[model samples]
Structure formats: C-alpha cells, structure tokens
Target: MVLMLGFVTIVAAALAAGYLLGRLRPWRRAGDWAADQVRFTGAWVRGGVVRQAVVVLVHVVTAPRTSWRIMRTPAADTTAPVPVRDPDWVAHRTRADKGGTP
Candidate 1:
C-alpha cells in the first residue's frame, strides 16, 4: 500500500511538472513542431489516397445540402407588406417640437 501510494505521488508530480513545462512558450512551440512533423509523416506514409479520401468524405457530407441551396430557385413571396412610417414624419415632429409651423 505504501509503495502504491509513493508511485501515485511520483506520477502526479511528474504530470504536474509536465503540464507546467508544456505551458512555457518554448515547450509549446516544440510541441507544435513535433505535432506538425508527425502529421506530415503520416500524410507522406498514406500518400494521396488519404488526402483524396478526406476530400471525398467532406464533399459527401457537405455538398448535397449546399449544392441544393445554391441550385434551387427561391419561393415567391406571398406575405403581406410590412407597415412603415412615412419618411416625412420625423421631419414634421422635429419642426413641431422646435415651435416651427406644423
């Protein structure tokens, strides 16, 4: 039980230290570089097949709805016209409030 507790403590301390170090700018940049390198290596290994598959998958998921919206004509408007105040109403109010002629 004591040995297990010690091991857990050591792991917790290591994780905390790693988290702190990862928050530093240099460490963060290094991590990003490593991640990019890994991604590049993965893409190189998979060749064009994975890239084409990803494109096809994205198109299959998104193209139908977007293409339909773009190609389809809009429905005709049938709603009643919205009521709006006359443009001269504000000018009349301002003149009346300033003691000018109605």
Candidate 2:
C-alpha cells in the first residue's frame, strides 16, 4: 500500500511539473519574440544608404584587399512573422475567428 502511495505521489508531482512547464513555454517564447523585435527595429534603423556607403568606403580603403564571396543561399521560407495586435483586438479577433459575435 505504501509503495502504491509513493507511485501515486510521484505521478502527481510529474503531472504538476509538466503543467507548470507547459504554462511557462509561452512566457519563454514571449521574451524571445520581444528581443527579436527590438533587434529587428535596431537593425532597420541602422541600415541605410549612408551606412552602406561608409561600409563600402572603409572596405575599399583597407590595405589588405579581400575577395568577397557572394554565396547564393536560399531564402528562409519556413518562419512566419509574429503578429502584433492589441489585447482588445486579439480578443475580438479570437471571438470573430471562432464565429462568435464580438
């Protein structure tokens, strides 16, 4: 009977741990998503014709001339952009998507 109780307790703990980790998955991804957005925005702001020209000039002026290897890599077709929507808009959209009148 005590062995059965021990087994039940272990099963309960495993289930509780699984539930907590499942709940944490979204929060972990949210942090990563926010970081990606910030990096993308920073890169967008930094990238411009002027920056490109400066980079070109620096490369040209450097003494050791290096041959650029232009590799034609296939574009990423799998990853989709994360949709940014207001909480209220999301709630409405969720309801609308479910065929409920929002």
TM-score, cand. 1 vs. native: 0.26
- Model 2, stretches more than 4 Å misplaced? 26-102
Question: Could you tell me which residue pairs clash in candidate 1?
Answer: none
- Would you list the C-alpha lDDT of every candidate in the order shown? 0.60, 0.57
Alpha carbon lDDT of residue 59, candidate 1? Answer: 40
Model 2 quality (TM-score): 0.32
Model 1 — which ten-residue stretch has the worst lDDT? 30-39
Pairs of residues clashing in candidate 2:
none
Lowest-sum lDDT 10-residue window in model 2: 63-72
Q: What lDDT does model 1 reach?
A: 0.60
Report the C-alpha lDDT of model 2 over 1-102, residue by residue, as the tens digit: 999999999999999999988988865564454444333556524768775454444433341233132113454689888998677865556666888876
